[model samples]
Target chain A: MSGTWINLLIDIIISLSLLTGTFFIFSASIGMLRFPDIYIRLHAVTKGSTLGIAGIMIGAFLFLYVEHGIVSGKLILGMIFVMVTSPISGHMISRAGYHNGVKLWDKSVRDDYAEAVKEKRKSIDN
Target chain B: MNLQIVINIIIALMWMFLSESYTFSTFLVGYLLGILLLFVLQRFIPDSFYMDRVIKVIKLIILFIKELTLSNIEIVKLVYKPKLDFEPGIFALPTELKSNWEITILANLISLTPGTLSIAVSEDNSKIYIHAIDIPDVVESINDIKETFEKAIMEVTR
Candidate 1:
């Protein structure tokens, strides 16, 4: 009875992890299509790609958790490491875009950051 | 506690778990070998000086989480809004915080936030240039960031 219950739990976790992976991929696809401009699209892709891959790997790991307990753990650690590092690299590219004055699509409208800069200057003057 | 030994133990345990076997011989070999590898690898790696600034590091992490959560919610709203309200522009937020470590943290926090991206950390490290989406009140946002986050970093690290 205990053996059957344990198997059921592992299977459920694996199924949930798969759902998580699918959601990430779906999000990435939507982001790639809907975001305006290369910069914003790039931003979406960067985040989406990292998260999507992590989710898929986690799902696979969970599925193998019963037979290979430690495998999932290492995969989780690797995913965390990638999650931390990949965005930094992606930002480097986005930063380059801003420096080059890449145009933003007007369809995307609320850029409050520009006024924020003026205020920062005012504070410095005071 | 010996850091080396601590690391070795972790490695050994990880190995035993990964292989999914509990043989005494396997555990003994893995434990010794991991310790040896760590000692050899430690010499090749140059340690950063900022390890001493634990408080600053902790503050940075807290700030990052706060920004991430807030920005996530903000972006979701923008995405779902009946009218698209996004004016993405590169704006520089000048900083008085001088520590290089803090500056790096600042850049990362910007990137981590959903609606904002850290574009550049000024060469002099005096300014952080970020591109914020639909920032309603700049000073308020900056103040909120500084008071709620940067101040903590300053307290601990500087």
Candidate 2:
């Protein structure tokens, strides 16, 4: 917060991966937009966005450390947690949606899970 | 539970640091805020309930690594075979575990290992059909896969 605005601008400009990181975030956003099914979208939302956002936030955080000397530990720590939890949470939500009887898109191939469960139950009951 | 998640975040921070990108303030704030936010969000998102999520995850990773190492060796041996070492096909492996988390871990572990792909898991979470690179002794391989991975999932998630 203490650095001059121009100095901060220079610091932000210099970090190359920050741009790359932004690019990943863009791809993730596009993936979310383009994917047809909730399941497919969940994959993007979880894996792509999680990694993308983590990269961007971490890149931005790196900029702060070099420029402002703020060396903000809290934000970096938050990024790590987000990286870990986001995918797990995302996967869980998708799984729940599947289990709670949300149907997959019609064009999707392989409903093996449904048949497997049905046969398993038939065997168990018999 | 919140406290545990916070601890998990702290542990994660140590990992990030090892990767050597440290915004000391960002790390601190992110750890606390991320855990807090995740816990708040957990309430609204409905999912298969997992009481032993952390343990289950750890167990899954360990089991997957073991399977990967073993399968890598298997792949190596098959590579040298003179007469096409495998007749690959898909088979359904019976699974009793119903938890979505556990089933996914099972599928992922299968997919992660060499020579196997978890093509499908039953919606009711009973059987998983996997395609093996070498469909040798379907029952035995299925058992090995289950014992190596699914059992661990059941033990932890149960």
Best by DockQ: 1
Name the docking class for model 1. acceptable
Query: What would the DockQ be for model 2?
Result: 0.04
| Candidate 1 per-residue C-alpha lDDT over A1-126 given as tens digits, one digit per residue, 9 for 90 to 100 | 999999988888878867766766666567667777766665555555555566678778877767666564777788777657755886788766754667667754444344544565788899
Per-residue lDDT of B37-137 in model 1, one digit per residue for the tens? 76567655455222335546676666665654454444444444666556655566778778887776656655666666666666567777666655555
Segments of candidate 2 deviating more than 4 angstroms:
A1-14, A119-126, B1-158
Error of 1 at B55 (Å): 9.3
Candidate 2 residue lDDT tens string, B1-158 = 55556554775586567657777775776665655555666665355323347657776666654654454344434433455434454567788777777776666665545555555555556777664554565446567756767667776766
Kindly report the docking quality category of candidate 2.
Answer: incorrect
The CA lDDT at A68 in model 2 is 78
Per-candidate Cα RMSD to the true structure, in Å, reads 8.7, 13.9
- Tens-place lDDT digits, model 2, residues A1-126: 656887767665656657655655565566566554555445444444444555567777777877578788876787667654654465456557655777766544344456655676799899
Q: What is the lDDT of residue B21 in candidate 2?
A: 74
| Residue clash pairs of candidate 1 | A109-B86, A109-B87, A110-B85, A110-B86, A110-B87, A110-B134, A111-B87, A112-B135
Worst 10 residues of 1 chain B by lDDT: B45-54
